[model samples]
Target: MHLARGAVFSLLLATGLALPGSEGSKHHANKARSAGYALKEPPLTTPWTDKVGTEPWPEYPRPLLQRSEWKNLNGVWKYQNASGLNAVQNPPFGQALAQDVLIPSCLESGLSGVQADWALYSWFSTSFEVSSSWKGEKVLLNFGAVDYEATVFVNGKKTGFHRGGYFRFALDVTEHLVFNKQNELLVFVHDPTDDGDYVIPIGKQTLRPSHIFYTPCSGIWQTVWLEAAPVNHITQLDIDGNMNGQVNITVHSSAKDAPAEAEVTVHKDGKVLATHNGPTNKPFQFTVPSPKLWSPNSPNLYNVTVKLDKDEVESYTGFRTISRGKVDGIERPLLNGEFIFMFGTLDQGYWPDGLYTPPTREAMVYDLQVLKKLGFNMVRKHIKVEPELFYQACDELGLLVIQDMPSLRPSQSKHVENCKSVPILPDEKQQAEFTRQLDVLVNQFKSFPSIATWVIYNEGWGQITDYYPEFGLTDRVRQLDPTRLVDSTTGWHDHGAGDFSDNHHYANPQCGTPFYSADSSPFDPSRIGFQGEFGGIGNNVSIEHLWKNQAAIDSINRTYEIDTTIEAWNYRSHILLGELEEQIRLFSCSGGVWTQTTDVEGEVNGLVTYDRRLARTDEKQWQADIKALYDAAAARSNATTATL
Candidate 1:
């Protein structure tokens, strides 16, 4: 039933009578819009949202591997919503679309100009022309990501299809292009985050969101563009290095001509350091002279250029070593073969205006820059997989990352039950799909030097706890990438696997130490430990700083804490860090991750406000406290023994 405006809609709004589940509620929302009710004003926008003009992310999307002359197709496109029986199959080929949505922005984002509640099936159409200079080059269409699934049509011919939602994919559309004249391009997308008959990996997304979980972003949420490439082009670059500056490089290429010849060059400060000539699709080794090691203080990086036949791509890498061993009888992780305590905050990567997509690149980089300025050396990028540039920023800024694999799970309630210590085992099909997704995630992200650890599962969200070790996920990850540390289970349900022993606690966390196994084995002094998550202190800001959405406001009303003023919150945080300082004595705790980097949705527990317009803490004080914590950690590492 379509809802009419004025009295009828006002009654529904006043009574808070929403439809049952996600499917019914979203269909109702679309119907309500069709009957003519103006969109609600955006709750809050970032500092960079206003700067996003016609072409929001005009900068080249691929930072690590860049080409000279690819077209950036990020602007307004004609769109239409269709959710009936066969909507996905029916293409509105030459027909006019009723609405406009900004490409690269998700359906629910205000920046898209649609702000839809949900769109399970939708159509997007646009027109473009092949560059005149490229007469016979292959036209490649690329998408950084499309929510769940997408099918592409160029000039009324099916080009390709993709399923995974967290990585990049491309298609060769040379066969379908019209070349000299304007070519028509159409896309059909389907995303069943939590509404349809099937479910996928959802990182804290919900239809009726609570304080922490938030509304999901649907449809295209990243950059999309077209590139011209030669027949034999370089596809990927994998670069790795060690303490002695022995750099290893591998060039993956689309070599129709087998054994394509290639060349690799290394540079620092625009001066040549080393060079190597080799064949495509094989490892090539070289050495940098008198290497200046990469660290949080120095952040040294070396630029690299690769050429394969008629193709060339530029990239970068850094030199460092990460390992774990007994420092003085207690095991601890060492960076550059030396003990350096890892300190960071949990970053969720959510935005008020763009949802999954950041308002702009500058806004996205600001979070990492702020944390670095506050004296943090690391961050645990929880659950969600970010775009490649995020990792590039970490590599350049000298911030270590503990990356997480996105989890597939069931629906959530008002609060997390069981302290998030239990796992709901999936059946054979779900388990298989999970493994497939995990494979794609690891294969795409293994080359970055900033990633120090890979978390296989978090808080038992998607683990088959009883059969975890037997299932061989830990073993699989170990085989996939043997260079980095693996975390089998982050918070709980530790089944005697992985490298580190981790736990989570709130309010006062120094109460006790976590055991390494589920059978409660005595603390193993030979293993490293970390406080994966802790200290969720809340500091309430004024309404202008809070997210303006009604659902978020309601959650804030229900979950906001007593530290209402900045002075009170600072005192509370000071006392909490004092507790953590004491925790360093037990289990040889080498690191701590504060609950989050910034306020997200209605979770008013951040050092800064949701809009990033207000900082609730003194920056200098945070830096000093962090320095003192590192001092204490250094002292702890020197101890000959520690109490369990």
Candidate 2:
């Protein structure tokens, strides 16, 4: 299969194709040579940057609810940043697009190959022919996510419109389908991204990114695909792990009338363990004799199959229960009626090349793999909702997650200011939208067993008032999902609601730190104690891959110079571990979460780099340290529970 360099070039050119190295070889070579020695600036790429070729992010975006027949609408598509006159109401489908950009990845990301700033309007046009095999089935166009607002068109007809950037949405394009004929799929996007007057949740995105905030990501940032399903099909599946060797399942069907009777089967290793027949759009409980409990040590997940008429869907769920119980007079998170210390890092899930989107499926899996390998049991997905795949990965890998609702119009000054109280309030419109978004978020992610906690607000970022007369946000979350615990607000400006008393500390945490540590017994009796965030030990990797902002870089380089090398970073990790052990021993604290899992743009306070290049501590040493911490904590729990 191999050929000579010249022969390969000749053959490719003869076959009306350009060789891999011939298209932009010279430019790449020049860039590589100029990266370090000759050039003043470093290369804006990671080791996996070049891996994003042709069809990037080709994995099935939704693993929880999977379908066999689907088309991956990822890869290069005609794109144009609609500015000035180009920002039209309708898409220019017939005309040649100004440029080509990769789908799924946002326009601002390097993987898209169109690193453009956030545009007020943008258009994406692509043509697809309906598969002859999917003739009778209903065609559904699914979008993993589209930032702020998106208007989708099919064959010159407006199909649907969607708002919000973090959750999945779908459109039924069966009506607009033309059999065998090529159909034009067009999408128009508009995102204000924290700059607009409307208060929309932007997570950590900022117009002028500095310190903790990152560059704004706009447009389609997740996968776009088409799936075929029977008219009467399973729309949603919600599973709640019960204590009595059973799981409560609710199946939402698409049919309006009493849906056909559905059959549910639970299996492990192709061996059927349990079965039940229930009507669609109803809740059913199934029990497994001697059910295997799912935990960090043994993540036993059972495959589930649902069949209704011609529709069949496959899913998986873990049998586990999460609740609060007292351990040594301190309220702690209990899994399966046993006290388990929550040990995790703050997973922001950002990337160097792919801003909100991951470069590839493997890249996304790799981050979770690293976390699992490091022997951590949980991850607080800080402030941003990730694609379902991230939660699925956590489910499969047995990592508990505390999901944070992305904040809107976060005031950094208010967050950091020393104030006992302030009349923080959101406009009527903004408040309504925020409440709606939170409901959407809860409904979107309520199925996953790995999500042990729902973090309603963080650091008083978007939390306006202590109470909402018409059922508060945290109360709403509890009502939506009573299965999991809720951290109403993580740091300051606690609404005095939710299950956990959460707090945050920075730099170096020691004993006698108020709210950060207990130092004395008999802490707040109302809620479980948890240090939601602490230990931001920053360590720089290669300056070549640093963020473009020199001022931000300089600021980070100056402030966090203490942990310059891996050795120093390991020392810091040990120091943090010692502090955690102290918190577990003397404080009788329920849980603790490290500052972050990876370095973000313009912020070096992460266990690993943004590109996932370097780790602050050696894998073996870190895992061993974490394992010891867990064992010690578990032993303490056993001793405390024995007396009870």
Candidate 3:
């Protein structure tokens, strides 16, 4: 709701909308100085826009292998932006070159009516009509994301091509359907904005935006449609719970010698406790009897169905564990079985008016219920990755998630030489589309139990330099989820593989070393630390919710204006909340997330403000100074468990 930098640059210079073609009319002399910056648009409604017509993303976006006789295929589509490959093989269709663009927003958004260009390659044709009850199933097609690359065609051949933008890709098109008439459904995207050679995590983007990057998101920014399945279903689901609570369930199929069976079940106040049937390619254990645990204050979820025979699928599960222990004697983080001190925020799920899509789905569950009503239990989503109903609303509103990986690298400096690299290594082939989009983001979020951690370079962006100590990219992300917790690199350059000891301080917040010490009878398994990015605190509150413009906001209001009122924004938010509560009481600080939670675009530091409708501090005195730093880390975990 905060967009006013002289009215969105006079509505993008009264839509003369340049820079997408004839070199956007040769950047009309730096288009009014890049029309006050912040430009990346494409996301036209449908995040479930007030039900009815233009069928908004009508739910059912694969809730972990679900299928209830489908056929949504969003609505109103027929875009155009071609640049070679023969204008996407001849497509000027029904003329009108512009207007009517809504299938899963993105065309530089404003509900994507082809807003000022950021397109690299585009052509999203459409024409539906096969739903005589999905005449003989198997259609499929889903793509809840498509930033980097995509290509699909039907009724003109070429069926699939996905190359990681942010995961999720499916295609079956039942032998190119043409059944009860009207077919055609072409698609072809190719983003590469930021020329960083892909693996895109150009967070706070920038072709040339300023201070903490801004704009630059490109091509097909999430959600596409079409569905119909059966001919043997449930193509994926892999849950794995432990911390001695036991729960492993794997079920994947697209008919690899068919003959698969699974039945699982496990609900809670909707009955059923245990069911379990086997063979869907192994692994199936169960046990919960007293297992509610899932944190950020009891998230508790269960309700999983699975069944395959008459093709049934419903999902939800949470048991939580996240490890690395030793509390008072240092080390840290250990959810389910204690030492829990992960206070949060660094979200970066931007949107001045839907930038990385989120105009609804209750504005992505009201930005995780306003960071759990500003008491934030956790969320370091930063390098962007959402929609799975935003981690199923952070596993049904209990938060706790670290999950990064949207990085491609760039951010290191010793006066710029090697200015942040990663131009392919790790057995290149362009790191095979970032290992096939990090194995479709670790198989659609490794059975999310409110993800615990999985950072993998941020601060080193795409890394690589002299093969950063023979990069075993955090042992290739612990061989893809040896069940969460892998912070390979969060800040600086520390190539000492995986698990904590990460650091990044700004606007100052420290904890460089010290896991434990007070006649240490615990803590200190090779010094585990993590500040992993500190405070930023900028506070602009709409300079056209600045991405930039107005002589770059009069050169950042004449170089960082300091005149302040409203009692100096509450004494600089109570002196940056007492210097982040003394860096969360020094010593063996096991938690500290901050560096964000709103105010994106020109990165105005944020503690809410870029349309989560303001809150730069004072949510009841920052929730009584974050409940007195969680009661001094619960009195140092009860005086280290009363000295054992």
Candidate 4:
């Protein structure tokens, strides 16, 4: 593994609450003293080990809006770190001394082959020869995601720069292609982590790795690829369904004022439910009486086919309504004409080995499937944006999501006050970076059907003292996709502007009496009560898997006992689970999402381990308990309706 020259020193300077000195220093010291030195190299175990490819991440990245013709450009790439300003220069290519790292995986990840210590800025270059199939077709270069900021070049020609790291960006490179000759693709990435104020929700990332925080991940961390498309191809599609069961469809194209027509057909059980035709700009509405609503239990979906002349694209849509209305004289979230409680986990979607990238497409799908199996109907995706395929799997497998806008640089005043508990950007420049990234995140995933809620801020991380300005972030999301609900704040320090009164309570799941009072009160949970984050149960199954470098069996047992009994419970893993079930039973909870889905780095409070091989809690027992709570809530709602 190649360690970045200055990373260890920089990490030493940036260590916050963790032990003095850099993690690398601690790791090296521990390695020297240990007697069980089986080999010279560190253990090569990551979430992506079994799935690494010479040409990595070969799956079709975009499944929601797909095309039949494309090429996969994910594999080893020539890499070097350069100053962000000087990255435009053409670096020496194909040199062995220069680093060779795997594509779609970050430098910090084990699967990258070159496990360099994380760097702030880097350049990646790769070459491919165009096929002689068709010379006139448009070639598009696509990036699933790149952290913080990235710039793309084709054969030394500057193409474009994208600011956000969590969203997809593409450039049409057909005009710049030199057919039948070797062409080069160069990418420059700049990720400040917490050093600068950027809207990257460096959620668990800190210079210090302890408790819930983790090691920083920077640079090009997602898939990079190239595809061929028709000159006048479909760029994007927006599908909106009304409460009246009428669906509005709009197709966007690069070709202007072309005589483009859209033929939309909805099918269920191999039978055509409805069909309609209209111009590209116009809305195509189709109605079905007593519509089959989409829910976690049934997840009824209608297949939608859109044909424009010779080009035909197929996708799916769900008929469901999410709104706020009065229930028992209090405003609460209504899902599909009924008050359904949402129980879920805060899914940061990070892996120990892969960092941001999953080992394989199946690995990504497995997380969502396991959540479903554990009886969770919803997932608050934390403060990170996932690939479209992750959301697509949620749609297909029947899961709800509360997508968060990645955190921005926190204000200095708020930063100082919350420094002990939260992660904040160290400077104002970082805040600007955070805003640009947030805009990109909102635009990219706004169209997904499974995403029912948008979270603007998590706790006080990256939050300003007066968070109303941050509500502008919520306003932007509302304008982009008004169909879904928005939570201005996920946890404490509420702005009281968005749809839910989100709260984070650990150990105890009780919503304060003042929060539920109908009388004049500041924090009223009855109005819009949602347990945004709670539960952090840590159950360490094996001593060998512990992150600590110390190898003594006795020390492992002592540490595990202290970490699990008091610290994990104090973090409220057991208490929150019990209280969460009770709150749903009492009919006071609208919906709730726990602190996390899996163990991340030093945070051992996840429901499952980082590798996702084991569950912390008894799965069958939890599922039965959750189902009982859900059933009780449903019965209460039914009885209230009967009285009406």
TM-score of each: 0.88, 0.88, 0.36, 0.83
**lDDT per residue, candidate 2, 1-644, as tens digits?**
22122221100001111112212111010111111111111124545667666566666777768888888777677778776324546468677677777777767777766777756678888777776788888999999999878889999889998988898998889999996878888888888876645578888887777778877788888888888999887778877765566878877878958657888888889789888988777778879777688887877788888888888888888888888877667677898888888889888878778888876666777777777877889999988888898888888888999998898667643332575554334677888888898899998888887899998777777677645322377778888888888887777665457777776766554322344433222235568877777788776545554565565565564334347566777777887787776666665567778877877776777766665665555777787778777876777776753221
Q: What's the residue-level lDDT of 302 in candidate 1?
A: 83
What is residue 410's positional error in candidate 3, in angstroms?
A: 35
Model 2 ranges off by over 4 Å: 1-43, 84-88, 412-425, 466-471, 510-523, 557-561, 640-644
> Model 2: which ten-residue window has the lowest total lDDT?
8-17
* Model 2 per-residue lDDT at 330: 66
TM accuracy, model 1: 0.88
Candidate 2 displacement at residue 118 in angstroms:
2.7
Poorly placed runs, candidate 4 (over 4 Å): 1-48, 90-97, 196-201, 242-244, 256-259, 268-271, 281-284, 288-291, 409-436, 512-522, 548-575, 585-587, 640-644
- Candidate 4, residues 1-644: lDDT per residue as tens digits? 12222222100011111211211111010111212111112122434455455555666777656766666677666677676656556444443325666677766666665555657778777777677674767788888888767888787677888876677888998877888887878777877665643445566555434445555566667766676677776676677655567786777666757868777887877888788887775545668655677778877777777777656666777888877776664456778777777888889887766767776777777778778887889998887778788888888888999888766543322245546654443345755656666666665666567888888777766776543556776787788777888887777667576888776765345442234322112446545777776655444435334443222112222222224333343344444566666665554567777767876655555666665655555555667766765786676566552221
| Prediction 2 global C-alpha lDDT | 0.73
Candidate 4, RMSD to the unseen true structure: 9.4
